[model samples]
Target: MTDLLETLIENREMVQPNHANMLEVAHGGNVMKWMDEVGAMSAMRFSGETCVTAQVNRMDFERPIPVGDTAYITAYVYDAGTSSVKVRLITEREDLRTREREKTTESYFVYVAIDDENRPTTVPKLTVDSETGERLRQDALEGEIDGNSDKS
Candidate 1:
């Protein structure tokens, strides 16, 4: 079993001119790419094997990350099956000067562990033993529920 907290991965990238779109905000594609990278890292950490993206459930870009601000990407493996790991990803816009942050995107990514032959491989179960781990998992679950409810 792997602790859910152990699978958490956080990364930040400063939005440069090249990474921005016409409006001078980080491009959607760039944000998705960053999310994928961090999500894969979280899955690999939990599985102890190379992981490849299987699906991206949803990506809601609620706000823009302006150039010169920091884009913080956070990911963690919240659940896993025989060979699949589900990760929750959240992207936030942070002003380095003031250390203020606001969420800009949220998504769930699924990854499958692979062996040397590129075949799907089994992964250990995810465990949420600590209070913080449980809270994180619960929060992700609630977010998913809230997102889905809004569609109706």
Candidate 2:
């Protein structure tokens, strides 16, 4: 069984003018595209099978990544279902001049494993053996909190 806690993948891309919007920041759609791709890759690496995006929970853009900067996207599988995997994606913007980075976006995505025939396939249960894995598991659970729920 592959350890899901320590598993991670990082990808970097240079933000270009074409990727920006009228405000001169990376477009929300472009960022979403990057996240989806990275999340799918992480799910495939963990499950060892092809996977497709089933759903994406609220994706919050915390900050804007300006053009000419580098965007670093990292993904990890935090939960696994019978035929689905949940991935956490973090997007950060690295300033080229000052050498600083700021988190620009965060999101949770669920992917369904697929067979060679493109049908849903079952995936192995996730095992977390380290602190990182445990933390990720906890984060996943906490993220399930319904923000819209009314409580006294």
In candidate 2, stretches whose alpha carbon ends up further than 4 angstroms from where it belongs are 146-152
Model 2 pairs whose backbones collide: none
RMSD after CA superposition, every candidate: 2.5, 3.7
Clashes of 1: 0
Candidate closest to the true structure, highest TM-score = 1
Q: What residue runs in model 1 are displaced by over 4 Å at the alpha carbon?
A: 146-152
Instruction: Give the per-residue Cα lDDT of candidate 1 at 146.
Output: 76
lDDT of each: 0.92, 0.85
Clashes of each: 0, 0
RMSD of 1: 2.5
Worst 10 residues of 1 by lDDT: 143-152
What TM-score does structure 1 among the candidates reach? 0.95
> Backbone clash tally for model 2?
0
